[model samples]
Target: MSDSQKPASDPRYPDIRHVAEARRLRSQGALIIDALGGIILCPLDTSRADLRILDSATADGHLLTLIRKQLAHPESAELIGTDIADYPPLDLPENITLEKQDILKPWPEKWEAHFDFVHQRTGLAVTGGMERAVETVRRFIELVKPGGWIQLVDGTLIDHKIAEDDKAWVKLFKVLSQCVTLVGLDTSLGVSTAEILKRAGEGLVRNIGEKQGVSPLGKGASSKELEELGYVELKGMHSGFVTMLKGMPEDKRPTALEQVEGLLPEVLREAQAGECEMRWYAAWGQKI
Candidate 1:
């Protein structure tokens, strides 16, 4: 269907709850190493006792937990997290406070270069425009004290081949990518982040670490777990795409959801089979 004619009630994108549930499954050993890596970058000192942290699109605060676990004084670092939706129904740590705001706009008047560190994940692709999103990141970096850190964790939806290829999986990827673009977002991180940072005048973009993995059902004990995790991660992607499509004319809604729904079972079956694998990318850099 043409972008202009799509409906407004297409399924909603997955929320923090869904994303958190996926993380929970992964924590339970659902072969989600890639998810884990994307959530928390390694080479982190965790011991840096005093840090001002800002988690953008902090859905359910899963990444917060991961960072807290890795840091030395989880209780001591100051944190401010924001999301476009109402803050997810997750408890904030004593050290962290939640704010509801749009990151694409100017930084809040109350927050003035107060952070020592800033972290954002997943929201880059949801923010509508790459240039605007990168500008937001630039603002985030501006909020941090010089010599502080700015870490970003995100993934692209582009699929890479493993041992086997399924037409269903391929079709699913294409539809989802289209759905994302329809909303003015890009699903591929490898395609944009560095350029975004550079365009924003971010200095010395160093790759702290990188990882890639597949989401399948039974490749190992971890495979089934990954499937459960996919439900969460993909739910967010699905919701975001649907929200964008829903903005279109009403008649085209069903066709879009049908395209999405039709692929879910096959994707689920692959997850269950544990034989297919998809690529997930991750990277982190410091603001010098």
Candidate 2:
């Protein structure tokens, strides 16, 4: 359910196997919900009749599933998940539907002001860059009804709390951010979440809210749940790093690959022995 309208061959869109990515998305979704303390923020009234929600970039529809379980009146809600691809888990309740959507493009006119809530997360991989991010948020605003809510979440690479001495772990993340930039995506997506929401909504939304949360990794993990979440995040990032390697020039690719590979063990050790955290930001606004 990642958001990439680009062709599957696009280097920016890592070719992770569906099974692996699905696992990552599920874990990430759980982590986000845990961080936020709920699936729907923005002061939603979930019991409203015919409530509607859209999860953009809804890879594997994991988030929608979570919503379904948590909603006060799940059966009354119109739950929709959209992504570049159309594969939805068969177990999704009848209330939930998955569709193929390229959020970078204009959406259907019928969808304008249609949902009660719109959600997007981890979209820097395909949102192009900072400018495109604003556009994407604007699109999300257009999809919700008047007085409805739109929420955005993303990882703030390098905007995290790590021990000053954890140089190896820090270096690994720096390289990862560089790889994302090399692939033409914005590494600053996370920190820019609030700004993007504000810029995009302009006069269209009100009461914009923003917050940041940490997903602990390795030994910095405060609980077993967070420890596992860290590992899941690390695995997903490693896969993305390898995929980005293919886009590099022949001369640089090998060295970059070796460097990442060599860093894994030491980084893993550091993570398990000490504290590491992935910082994330979420912003939301109610459409006026």
Question: Candidate 1 at 87: error in angstroms?
Answer: 4.5
What TM-score, over all chains together, does every model reach?
0.73, 0.88
Query: What is the Å distance of residue 220 in model 1 from its true position?
Result: 5.0
Across 87-169, the per-residue lDDT of candidate 2 in tens digits comes to: 42557888898887887889989899999999988885577677887888888898999989999888866624345565766
What lDDT does model 1 reach? Answer: 0.56
**Shift of residue 182 alpha carbon in model 1, Å:** 2.2
* Tens digit of per-residue lDDT, candidate 1, span 1-288: 432223322222332334344344334223345545444553445578876778877745555666676667878887777765542256657777777666767887566667666776666776666777677777877776655566665556653432235456555566566655654566665446556656664464444444554545334334454556555544444454554555557564424565655565665566456544455444455556
Which model scores highest in TM-score? 2
lDDT of each: 0.56, 0.76
Cα error of candidate 1 at position 251, Å: 4.2
